[model samples]
Target: MSTRTIQTSAYGGMNRKLRFNGKMKSREIIEWLREAKQERYYTILKFDEVILNSAIIAEVLDLLRISSRHGRVWERVSLEFCEGPVDLVVSSLVLMDCVRHLFLASDKIQDDLMDRLSTALRISTSLKSLWLLIPMTEVSATHLGSAMKYNRSIDKLSLSGSNWENSDDSDSDSDDDTNDGSKSLRPKLFGKQNAGNSPVENQMSPRDAAMSLALGLKYNDGIQSLDISCCDLPDEAMAPIIDGLVGHPYLEALNISRNRCRIQSVEALGRVVEDDDCLIRSLDLREQSPHDALEISPLSFALRQNRSLEALRISHNELVDSQVLELVDSFRGNASIKELDLEHNNITEKGIPDLTKYIKELPSLTKLLLGGNAIGEEGFNFLESLEDDDDSICTITEEDLRPAKPRSTKTAKTSKSTAAAAVSNNVSFLTGIAE
Candidate 1:
């Protein structure tokens, strides 16, 4: 169907799409906000690296607040900036009346923008959520740290940049027949500093940025959740952050995924988690350590002793049956941790029964996510039989669990091998939390 036809049927013939030329017009945005407000619908403005004029943003935001007062738009509007932009921030929009979820690519943010952001974070009471994609400069990081020092408005601060972004291009049919294999390193930090910039100005070392964040966390009260996924942090930086997070009053959720966090550093955090005073409950330690066997013992031992943790995600760390058994043993008869996420692990059917044993031992087991495993139909059925209802296996995928079949055609085999070779050749380019 045509877009106009779809809109006519969906919105009673209302025009919501905005066509921008050089700049995003405030008048156009104001009208969109008004229409969306009157209809009680959502309002979203997605820009493709377009230049965002502070005047336009401020005017639209002010108009949006008025529209909400007159019964238009939802409580929050989404402004997402994909693939960093050469941005300019005149002043912090913190004084703006409307609530907005802002996503800014760290690599794309310019110098002036950082200053404005710091100003906004320092004073703006309207900034609800902020997402800073990695590769921001040290100055920007320090400014961010200063902004979050005492401010209590922001609830979520995310810097998670996972490898393998969403791709739309079609794949070429090629295959690799050889058994030659190699492990690809995690995604590296994005973007390079402009020429002539100082070392600290080039890109903020995760360690120094983390130290600044630790300073902010010491005084932070409003932000309750923090995500630093794919942000490279050496042991020196990781250790301090763990030490700082021990008794943080407001921080309840922490995502340290893909930070090159080793078993030793995690052990330090685990020791703190054993404390009854720690407030953090929801934790995502997915792909933190390189060695699965090393990761199992320390964190599991900590979980067994902790009393506050309720939800844990530990996916993509190459967990085998034995390691999973050790983890399950830690959770067995535990008082906390009702939800467990074991996605992207190397688990198989042999470990299912051991994991299931905890279902009866601990009455609080509510949800279990087991996708990206090698479980077949029987394995899926067996897992479904664990709990009284099948609702707990929401993340389980039967296709991922099924056993691999022999190639039925030469062409198919060739294509598979070719893709593997392509990945192998370009593996060095793939970015991760560690450079």
Candidate 2:
């Protein structure tokens, strides 16, 4: 952790500003200095953490000829907290210098810090990539919308642990009734303020904002990758978001796992995948189950039109025999998709013949996940047949089928001994099978 010192010109034409460039190896210092100076003097200055102080931030703002106290230098700058509240203000001023990439993670973002952040967003037009790890939970959507309205530069935004719910126990009595209904489980809209509150609620759920921002990106051409996992959104909440993504040409990857999204959303998402102009390359919708069985008819429609999608993941759903057969059949003509994950489903031994029949039609199928299913020894034999060079229609080998064996067999008894023992054990637990 040796600190490397570098002298560079400050943003306001201040001479020989002392800045610490950490952990430079022995011979790389000269190359680093040359590369550092190759950019505009202001760009170099903004990267300098020493210039992130209030005096230097003010000087940089004035030098940029922006009169507002809230102006941005670059989209990103890191300032370690060495002091108190004043340091936080200095950091905000530095952030205001530009708005594209802002990574402000400190212990100070509690009550007053969010207010400053809202102000910063209002003034920072170029801000795109925002990673704020703060404690503030009551973020007003109006203020966030106001900030995002003029500023279209943000493509990736991540906010952690900001889902602040009401602290008052008065709402406890309403919890049971609210929890009883499926309608109450819908993802709550953040940034909407309670009546009479001047400041917006800090409890901006990341998933809610992610869905909004993703919808917003449909009009905006800059955003490409969106990761909103662990945000606590349900499948119903994602349906509209998926619908909004039908024609987006710029979006590439979407991760919406570990949320409450279910099979219905997946079914709806299949429509987006069917669009010819859709640019999605990877879609992750794991850990969401449908109220009923998962259907693959919509996915078959997607496979017919979507040529750009390279990977499709729909793990942890209750996929039945017919659904698996339909999905495998859909991939027969789809050469673009290389990876397919169908883990934690119920694709049985009875479905293996149909599964392999259509799987053999996919020439580009590289990685296949069939774990936590009921594919038996006969299914494995069918998979092994695909390993041969003469079986040019299928490219997967015995190695690809090896990892999926043990897990799928835990429930299904392959041998007579195991089956008899299982029946006996169940009988001892319950005398009548009819029970």
Candidate 3:
């Protein structure tokens, strides 16, 4: 009797043949695509620093579309380019058809380039979120309105940049304009407000354009969170933007940290908070310190009126002990606030007593950050005393304040060496907030 044998192909043998063309790396990409096809989700597709040509991006988008069945339910897509023409024309039909979360970051974005991109985004009816990271000066009012025209599904928008301040030399000719046969180049404090006009209308400033973009999106129902951090916006520039948040009912989180915004802008924002129509739950106005001569009473007044805010972050501001006490006092009787961050402020022992009193009174507060302040062992002791007396304060534990054993000199040296090695290897230590 002769023995007969049967052989079966690998588990994904057919799929591999159909997609990968028998190469291992290509097969992996194919496998990922197949998985994405089935799942209908994509996230964090970071391609920054790579000089990809227009054709390559088109191919990538095509592959994404093929995997996603033409982006019917794809969730997140992050495309970052460091060097390229910000405007790269593709199949407009395909680009306009995408309905998903889109995040675009580039270093060389220009007004004209953004206008074209905005035109494409305007047609994406299903876009749920839009994040644009570019130099703030590059963004114009025309581009902003065009991008937001048809984007009704977007619920979150974040725009970040580093250098937004125009150099003084650029405005040097303004002094001569007043004496010459030309009109003064000074910006008007209050200009004609046109409901239908672009923010860039009538020689408006760059800051005005930014404010217009923010205000333009106020009526958009899909917007829930807006973060415009590190944009270098000064007090005068941020005034209109702060005022624009008045009627934004759906806005929950607003972050304007690491900018040049002052107490005056914050006070203006406080005015927005007083409006019942504003639904902002969290406000981050960190890293903006007021000049010594400026009065701090307005900030306290603003905090008192912002009853709906649940989280307040005012870290890295050089707040005096009295101001900190006043701020903490304002939060008393307000129950919505659950977190307060005053880190990096020069708060001392004098401020701790008032802070402790406020914390004890605020029944809803769960997280309090006083890190990087002058509050050392004494402050920790005060917190410990409060914890001991109040059993209801369950969130923060004694372990959080307990100091770890001091590292030995050798161990410290070794750790530093390891960190240096990691830096040399280009390893990133960036991590998101823990949920």
Candidate 4:
């Protein structure tokens, strides 16, 4: 007798027809998988916070085993586990041949599971995109790097929150040697580590994990887009990773935002952009450590020399007038840049003239984001001057011109006449704007 056909209700794409959320009956899921035909119509499957047990594990294994034997199966699969045997479930999925994309997000994953997943990645030939949002250990990162050395199919890798704090080992510093005497290298990422949780086995160290990832990436040639944002990476740890990506041929987009990186790490990233073979088109360096005054000359130097980068985000880096001037001056001859984000920086009227001049000269720069800065009335006048020329190619949005804070009454009154004059020239250019 022919088995009953499973008609899934969820739809994410043309082939995405299966979706399981929260708890599911083991027998029903098992029956559905067992009865599934060779001509499986569903290619995408997602499981969110599903409770797990032995029957679920056995059923999943049976389905994967059958699908594997039938050759490559499945296109994309995502699993967000809240509890239960994550290692077993994830490992089985990783080993599946011809699974094009795999995303696993969980906080319960342990080192042994990460090791298994890394081993599976080493021999896989079909997976192309991998997103592991699980908490990671240094040993796990080392294994992952080793796996990346042999794997060439994956081009997009996101390890966002991979190094997030584990409940079992939250407050402990993973790298004690970093704090021995060096003032430059931070012992741990701020707001990311606290010392109250129960100790866990084989805890992750950010420095060692970053070093291992760098070593692995140095050999991997297929990765193009990489995201390690919000990983709580410090300068000492982040620098080596930047160093590894210096001469990468295929790597293009990199996001290292919201880290504890200081100037040392920034300089290393500058070297990567300065490389003659660098193909990086977009770079993000936002929300770095605000307490430290980072010198941005290295990035300016690299920008002046490099021609491949198009989009740059250095917002929330506490750039003052001098640094902003330096950055604008570097854009004089370089034409590849199309968008720049200087939002939430410390730029004021002192640097607006140079910025206006540069934006005018570089017609290629179409978007200039300056929001969240205290550009006073005079600085607003500088931007208004550009708006007077109706033929100008660049257009700064009103949002881009908004000030970060309220203007002081003294300064507001002092520049009242200048502001009025600027408004008269261009009534539509950020009218009634104040810092």
Which RMSD values do the candidates have, in order? 9.4, 15.2, 13.1, 12.3
Q: Give the count of colliding residue pairs in each prediction.
A: 18, 26, 1, 3
lDDT of 2 by residue, 1-435 (tens): 223332332212443221233233324434333443433333322231122444433433444344233332532343332223433543345354543454443323244555455566545556556544332333433334334444445665443212223223233222122222322211221222334333333344434544554454445554566554433455655566566667766778776644556556666678778777778888776545433455557766667777877787776667888887877777678778788888767878888887877877787877777776777888777877666664333322321111111111011212223222222322221122101
Where does the lowest 10-residue lDDT sum fall in candidate 1? 401-410
Model 2, residue 155: distance off in Å is: 4.0
Relative to the true structure, candidate 4 reaches a TM of 0.78
Worst 10 residues of 3 by lDDT: 426-435
Pairs that collide in candidate 4 are: 171-194, 171-195, 407-435
The number of clashing residue pairs in model 2 is 26
Regions of candidate 1 where Cα sits further than 4 Å from its true position: 1-46, 52-90, 109-112, 162-189, 193-203, 290-294, 348-353, 371-435
Candidate models: Cα lDDT each? 0.55, 0.48, 0.53, 0.66
Count of backbone collisions in candidate 3: 1
TM-scores, all candidates, are 0.67, 0.57, 0.67, 0.78
The CA lDDT at 225 in model 1 is 81
Candidate maximizing lDDT: 4
Candidate 4 to native Cα RMSD, angstroms: 12.3
Candidate order by lDDT, decreasing, is 4, 1, 3, 2
Candidate 3: list runs displaced more than 4 Å: 1-46, 54-58, 61-71, 82-99, 138-141, 167-206, 290-296, 376-380, 389-435
lDDT of 1 at 14: 41
